[model samples]
Target: MPIPKVQKLFQKTFFGIFSMFGVIGFSTSVLCVYTVDTHLSAEYESNSRDIAKTIADSSVDILLNRDLATLQSLIDQFVEIQGISYIYITDETGTFLAHTFVPGLPEVIRQSDPSNTDTVERNLPGMGDFVEVGSPILAGVGGAVHVGMDTGLVALKIQRAIGQQIYLFSTVFIIGVFAAVWFVNLAAKPLGELLGYAVALAKDGAKAPPSDSLLRRNDEAGQLARLLLHCAGFTDADNKRGVAAPGEAR
Candidate 1:
């Protein structure tokens, strides 16, 4: 059976370059997104936990005195902080002492274990997503202070960061494509000539000697072309009769 046709060196080289750049760009984008998400999520959660503990610490004395009004004012001031969507305090009995929710407290907030000190993600109906952080008031003696950090805002920041990175990588990939095309074309020219010469020699006796330009090339392709010429039995006198390409010595 006749051998199946194979892609030329030009096509293979260009495709290989393209694939390399594509893989690198895609991997970088994924890594950047993951890094941005991890760092931002951690920082936001830390901020929420810190704020919750701070409010809880300050509210300890106020809560002991049964100063609900002052506790409400204190949390009201902190609720204005960025990324903090809501704030609430609960008694040891789990009854809501004060909350920033407009209509009512969320069931998820009530379900949280005040004694457990951990950050958790929860979605409150009509309230979107939140990262809930609770700090026990007076180590669970006084009511616990819980803060809700907006997950939507955190996600938005991550998306914005990832978008910028993708844009940068896309720009680099585009520039790389052009460079790859130029490099492949530059590298393929001499290979194409050598292939044609080899194929001609195989099909019939190579009557036409290699050009002086091929003989005078300073690169590896020039060496291969000269080797092919020598193997083809073309003497120095034969190529000496041909003219070199401009700016090259035979």
Candidate 2:
């Protein structure tokens, strides 16, 4: 079916607005999500660090005393903490002396010999999807405590927040678009009627309609209406003059 130009214009304008809003909203939402994710991650890391330190401090003495039974019980207590995925006590040689998940001994202990101490914070393979934090149990002692906390829960939380924000922003965007269209139509009503009068004059050469509320204003639309009226006068004058050529033997 053939569509009117006004309908087409309105549709194009609406879609343009929708696209612009979508891009802006998506970018903003992504930034907000990332900000929340980073903040939550930092908080989790800080709290987890304190817990790991407490566990290490309380267990280091027992381990040094060679109290195997007490150390085992301490490791059990550490594992009982919520969100803790794994715990391991390792010596300077990177040998896993004890672990919560694997009993006896672990074949491999994940460790990096980075020039920078901060490299320990980097994610590594075989560590599962968790934040692995390690600290020396005692000053100048070759022993270290490694703790891993599952970050899957934190990721899930951020995802939920982003989804909710998308829904909320989409609703607001749609409402804003509708309101804009309504205001445009309301403001254009007078211009539409003025255009109709001009069209009738063009088609039938009828007397021009009286200048109404539209002509009283000094806006672009009012200026256009005045120009149209002036042009109509010129057209009528030309018709009345009816100039004839001398060669026609008048």
RMSD, one per candidate, in order: 5.0, 9.2
Q: Write the per-residue lDDT of candidate 1 for residues 21-88, one digit (tens) a residue.
A: 78987787788778888998889888888999999889888888898899899999999988999998
- The best candidate by TM-score is 1
Candidate 1: clashing residue pairs, number: 0
Q: Which stretches of candidate 1 lie over 4 Å from their true place?
A: 1-7, 64-66, 110-117, 196-208, 227-250
Model 1 scores what on Cα lDDT?
0.78
Error of 1 at 44 (Å): 2.0
How big is the positional error of residue 32 in model 1, measured in Å on the Cα after superposition?
Answer: 3.5
Candidate 2 structure, TM-score to reference: 0.66
Clashes of 2: 0
Cα RMSD for predicted model 2: 9.2
